[model samples]
Target: MTRDITIVGAGWAGLAAAVKATQLGLKVHLFDAANAPGGRAKSVAHQGQLFDNGQHALIGAYSETLGLIQTMDLQPQALFERQAMKWQYPRGECYALPQDAYPLKALRSLLFSKRFSVREKSTLLKPLFFSVSQALWGKTDDTVAHLFQGVSPKIMRDIISPLCLSALNTPVSVASANIFMRVLKDAFANPPQSCEFLFPRLPLSDIFPLPCLNWLRERGARIQLNHRIDDLQDLDPHVPAILAVPPWQASLLTHDKYPQWSMLAKHIKHRAIASIYVKGLRAESDSKQAPSSSYPGSLMCLNDHDESEDCVHPQFGLQRDVNASTRNSHPEGAEHWALIVSAADPNARQTIIENALKAACEQLKLSDVQLELCTVEKRATFSCDAHLQRPPCWIDSGLMAAGDYVQGPYPGTLEGAVRSGFQAVTQLVDASFVSSHAGNTSRVL
Candidate 1:
């Protein structure tokens, strides 16, 4: 098929590129090896219920992602259950405020909350102060551990370690300061409400993937599912193309042509995420209590620290059954625990899940919790470590790269993926304009 542009990999990035190209009046053809779209953000069907492969939260600061969803005509408020930004621990140290509150409001909450002592709070805020200051005058590129050695248990348990683990998907000792600062800067740049957690009301696929694919197909963009492109010659070479797959797949596809780019992408280390779903079954005697209000919040920061290296509890805990209190998904009057462990060891999934289920039940005060299912995306995100060099989006004149792993300030997030996809389409158009102008100049000469 003759298309103005072809998008490889129909995950968020590829779907995003196809959407933008269609908006720009380009003939777009999109393909993916998977049966469905969404890549790492896809949903899984188990026992007739849809659960996300992993917990993919949409922060208020995700302007590009939010805008893209709006363009698809999906109501943000309808699709997502919005809650104020809150940093909470299992033992209940909370830095929180209403939606769109200034970033300073979080600090205010911290100062007012009795969970951490003055010295302990100071310890937590000190590194943040340095990161903000570094964002201004100087360049600070180091690991989290180096930036704050002798990291006290109080401060670590309070917020820093868990936040870094969730944000970077890398251990604080090895995570990159550059990427960390970029996340902070992006957060501070957006509207105060941008930091609110936009937890999707529906399954992950219903959120963006299916809606987007429907939109594209409703238009004229060709959508090919379970189709793989083996070579560059297999695609429409006359048109520009965007390789929007994950770094591993991107590396494999480009190894024959762009060797250096391929190598850089191939060498990018990845972190894994485990989605451990447990059913919170209250005994029939406790059925009188409100099942919907059983959990304190939709999500909370978990203290996954155990002296034993074998016991790595989940870093985050969310209540999947209570997606929207108004909707009340748990008609059976049972709670479903959605626990997430970022930077998980693929081999030790069973250990992590076992520890996390027990710990989370105690922390959240669940009556009876039984393991439902546990799924892990081994290559969930890139290991955003110090001195990491990501590949560029613009690969060549006719080919471009589009994914979260590309050169960007943000970490591997949906926002990063969407931004890269939009940028890839822009690059394609810009390159064509430049080439046409060059030909015209030569003709005149």
Candidate 2:
């Protein structure tokens, strides 16, 4: 029980905690019900080819995630396709700041950028610069919808809505303004080059999970895949545990053992992320590698994002490897696309999938396409509403929770999940949760 930690659930969060605990020279036992890692963001194999269950991307601001990959000795650049964060539509309206550009030069690029009109550009910068005032005066502590008071419809249609949906997974009307502002500040003003997007070069699994399992095994950390933990009491009471499962599942495990904590975890609401996989994409319609570099076609915002309806889902379904090489992995090769619907209701899966696919086809000019699969991450992310209060990490003395749902500045993103897991283990070590079993606890950094 001494210096030994049990990590339940091997999603990004659980895996992160286990990694940190092992790095601090502790015994790590990681378990997940799923046969493979990557939790909700894992790659699913069907008909012999791999497809991501949910779409995932990274920003340079995700230092913890990037560091975790590096800790495994895997090159981040090798796993992902990096580009400056830009919101480009099929019809050509877009907005982005170059990765190498920063400060005044960046502002100039944005100011004169043809993405939006002169007035619309002001609408865009208002909230960004407004972050300065918010920091100086304290948090606005309101809904993101409030930020659009003077914004024109074009700006809302071409800009704000998509960013809000892609970032928060919640509509602008309810997404936390404080959190949204924090994301904007971190991506832009807080540091340099963080605005770049990191799209996985292959299936999401190959990006981190499988490699992490290998790294953990090599270090003598025990991993139990397809091993489910239904009851908390079944765990060695003396051994510390990190529950990184979804809030609902955690609620079930801790219902009687920790009623109050269970309530907190149970009360958290969730929104679904439905990933619609489409095949038979023609190269002319495939934007992943457009003839022109200016296309920025890897990820594009689709139409039908009704601002009044409060949805800003990104319509990304382009193939990552649109070459002959991928044909061996997937029958369609260059034609696989994973279109996503953020904040979709899982109960209405069929309706949502049908409408989303229709919108994507018409908007992206996709033709002769066939629906390969539809993955609905039932609890993709907790609803990031303005009124939300995320649960704390420490649930009890030797027990704690780790997930993006826990209290964090960022939204329910992979970075937030990674940071939470890493910090949970750090807290365990600092609090001497593993000290009685071992003497040298200074290894934790």
State which candidate has the highest TM-score. Answer: 2
Task: For candidate 2, give the lDDT of residue 66.
Answer: 93
TM for candidate 1 is: 0.89
Q: lDDT per residue, candidate 2, 1-445, as tens digits?
A: 3778989999999999988888778889999999999898788877766777776778888888999989988998877778776655666645656555347434665676787678777766666666668889896488887766567777676566677878888878788989987887778764455777787776778778999999999999999999999999779888888999989988899899799989998999888778777765555546563323442226767755563332334344444552321335545433456677777767777776677667556665566667777888777898888968778898888888999998889899999999999878877877777753344665432
Q: Each prediction's Cα lDDT score? A: 0.75, 0.76
Candidate 1 stretches greater than 4 Å from native: 1-3, 98-103, 124-129, 282-297, 304-311, 322-331, 433-445
Question: TM-score per candidate, in order?
Answer: 0.89, 0.89
Kindly list the per-residue Cα lDDT of model 1 for residues 306-344, writing each as its tens digit. Answer: 321212578777776444422435547567777888888
Model 2 misplaced stretches (Cα beyond 4 Å)? 104-109, 124-129, 190-192, 281-297, 307-314, 322-334, 436-445
Q: Pick the lDDT winner.
A: 2
